[model samples]
Target: MKNLVIIGGTMGVGKTATCRELQKCLPRNVFLDGDWCWDMHPFVVTEETVRMVESNIAHLLTGFLDCSEFDNVIFCWVLHEQRILDNLLSRVNHGGFAIHTFSLVSDEAALSERLSRDIAAGKRDPAVIERSLARLPLYGELDTVKIDVTDISAAAAATRIKDFLAA
Candidate 1:
């Protein structure tokens, strides 16, 4: 059976790290980070930018879905709203794939600490961290499964996802 796993969360929530760890547990899979598609210089977020990034993600996923070599396709992104999630799913060609979607959750204090560490290490901008933190509430309102990342390692979170897909 073909499986499409979409993982969403706020910045510094270990989405990418979990994806990397998740890769070790699943065979014959393709993984894509949505942020990688937004690698534009001086990132702009106009209507055009949103549409383009969504289209890009859809296009990349469409390719993976069509490929015969992969049975699992893992997508990691920050999907904080229902409309955004609906808009993204609308662009994809499911082709009868079984989809398991989840949102990684974290407490405010843990989130703040993670972002602070990232900022101190020069890995993330203060403004970006602020924007990401502001979206945490939206994540809780989503319909998908929520995996709390507080007090857990990325690898452990990945294991949880793998177990979820198996069930």
Candidate 2:
């Protein structure tokens, strides 16, 4: 069976970590970080870049959908709103797979600590951290599987996703 899993949340909430853990459960999978497509320095997100990014995600998903070796195709990004989710997903091929989406979440303090670590490691911009934290309430508004990583391991969150899929 083919499965497309889209993990979304505010930055520093452990979306990528959970996705990586999910890979352990379903190793024969194709995983793509959506930011890998268009996160570049001198970042200027105009309408054109947004369109290009959506197209790029669509192209990658279509390729993964065609690859039978992958039992699961996973993509994780900060899709803070339903419109953004719909915009990118509509571009995908929808290759007859059951698509599961989950939103990772955490308290502001935990999120702050995570982002601060990322900032210290120089893996993330300080501005992005502020912006992401400001959007915490927006994440809670999403209508999808919600996993709070404030007190749980990424593996535990992945286990919950697996259990949900099993049921």
Whose lDDT is greatest here? 1
Pairs that collide, model 1: none
Kindly report which residue stretches of model 2 are placed more than 4 angstroms away from their true locations once superposed: none
TM-scores for all predictions: 0.97, 0.94
lDDT of 2 by residue, 70-113 (tens): 88998999999988888877888886788898899899899999
Q: Which residues of candidate 1, in runs, are more than 4 Å off?
A: none
Across residues 25-89, which tens digit of lDDT does each residue of candidate 1 receive? 99899899999999999989999999899999999999998899999999999998888888888
Cα error, candidate 2, residue 120 (Å): 1.8
Best by TM-score: 1
